[model samples]
Target: MSWAVLVISGVLEAVWAAALDRSEGFSRPLPSVVFGIALAGSMGGLAYAMRELPLGTSYAVWVGIGAVLAVAYAMITGAESVSVLKVLFLAMIVGGVVGLKALH
Candidate 1:
């Protein structure tokens, strides 16, 4: 359950980040609201997850998932240019996350 919450939080982090990017410096009403909600929700979820998970492990996984998802989202949405080197780096991040998970 804690891990699940962490993953959700991470995904929410990505969502909020993307929302913030579209907020036009907070001038856009709808995107601003969405950004606020998602940002708060992500932090709230992370707090809940930290109750049971070790801080180091939880933080690493949370950040890793958020970063990877955000980059992938940007590439897929055409918000950023996708390149072979970028994809390779993203794959390395995924690999690191999986390796960390496999650690005792």
Candidate 2:
């Protein structure tokens, strides 16, 4: 359950990140609201997960998931350019996340 929450929170981190970018410094109402809601959810989930998981492992996993998803989202939406090297690096991050999970 804790791991599930942590993963969900990680995805929410990406959502909030993308929404924040769309918020344009909080100038946009809808995106800003989305950002706020997602940010709260993400943090709440992270805090909850930390209750059962080691801090360093949880943090690294959370950040890894969020970073990969955020950049993937940007690339898919054409907000960021995609490249072979970028994909390769993202795969490496995913590998590290999986490795942590396996170790845990």
Candidate 3:
């Protein structure tokens, strides 16, 4: 359950990150609202997961998931450029996250 919540929170982190970018410094109402909601949910879930997971492991996993998803989304939407090296790095991040899970 905790892990599930953590994963959801990590996804939310990506959502909030994208929404925040779309918000244009909070000038946009809808995206700003989305950012606020997702930010709250992500933080809440992270806090909850920390209750059961090791602090370092939980934080690293959460950040890893969020960073990978956010960059992937940006690349998909053309907001950021994609490259072979970038994909390789993202895969490495995923590998590290999985390694942490396996160790846990």
Candidate 4:
């Protein structure tokens, strides 16, 4: 259950990160509100999951998931360009996340 919560939190982290990009520095109303709420909810879920999880492991996994997802989205959505090197870096993030999950 804690891992599930952490995964959900990771997904929400991606959603909120995308929302933040679309918010245009909070000039946009709807996306800004959604971004704020999603960010808070993501943190809340992380806190709940941390009750039973090791802090270092859980936090690393959570951030890694978010980083990989965000980079993928950026590549797909043209917000950021993709390259072989960048993809390799993202792969490393995935490996780190997986390694943490395996340990946990």
Candidate 5:
């Protein structure tokens, strides 16, 4: 359950990041609201997960998941360009996250 919540939190992290980008320095009302809500939810989930998981592992996994998703979304939406190198590094990040999951 904790792991599930942590993963959800990681996804929320990506959501908030994308929202933040869309917010344009908080000038846009809708995206700014989305950013605030997602950010809060993500942090809350992370805090809850930390109760049972190792701090370092949880944090790293959270960041790794968030980063990969953010970049992938950007590329998918054409907000960012895709390249082989970028995809390769994203795969590496996914591998590392999976490796961490396998550890425990």
Candidate 6:
């Protein structure tokens, strides 16, 4: 349950990050609301997961998942360029996240 929540939170982190970019310094109404909502949910989930998971491991996993997904989404949407090197590095991060999960 905790791991599930953590993953959801990580995905939400990406959601919030993308929304924040579209928020235009938080001046836009809809994107601003999305950002605020996702931010709260992501933080809440992280805090909840930390109750059972080790802080360092949990936080690192959360960040890795979020960063990878955010960049992937941006690339997919043409908001950012995709490259072989970029994908290779993202795969490395994915591998590390999997390794950490295997550890626990």
Reference-based TM-score of each model: 0.92, 0.98, 0.99, 0.95, 0.98, 0.98
Score each candidate by Cα lDDT. 0.89, 0.96, 0.97, 0.91, 0.97, 0.95
C-alpha positional error of residue 95 in candidate 3 after TM-score superposition, expressed in Å: 0.3
lDDT of 6 by residue, 1-104 (tens): 88999999999999999999999999999999999999999999999999999998789889999999999999999999989999999999999989988999
RMSD of 5: 0.6
Point out where model 3 deviates above 4 Å: none
Instruction: Give one digit per residue, the lDDT tens place, for model 3 in 1-104.
Output: 98999999999999999999999999999999999999999999999999999999999999999999999999999999999999999999999999999999
> Candidate 1: which stretches are off by over 4 Å?
none
Overlapping backbone residue pairs in candidate 6 total: 0
Instruction: Report the Cα lDDT for candidate 6.
Output: 0.95
Winner on lDDT between 2 and 5 is: 5
* lDDT of candidate 4 over 1-78, digit per residue (tens): 999999999988998999999999999999999999989989999999999999998899789888888889999999
Best by TM-score: 3
Per-residue lDDT of candidate 5, residues 1-104 (tens digit): 88999999999999999999999999999999999999999999999999999999999999999999999999999999999999999999999999999997
In candidate 1, where is summed lDDT lowest over 10 consecutive residues? 95-104
How many pairs in model 2 have backbone atoms within 3 A of each other, for residues 3 or more apart or on separate chains, i.e. clashes? 0
Q: Any runs in candidate 4 off by more than 4 Å, and if so which? A: none
lDDT of 1 by residue, 18-56 (tens): 899999999999999999999998999999988988788
- For each of the candidates, the C-alpha root-mean-square deviation to the true structure, in angstroms, is 1.1, 0.6, 0.5, 0.9, 0.6, 0.6
- State which candidate, 4 or 5, has the greater lDDT: 5
TM-score preference between candidates 4 and 5, better one:
5
Pairs clashing in candidate 3? Answer: none
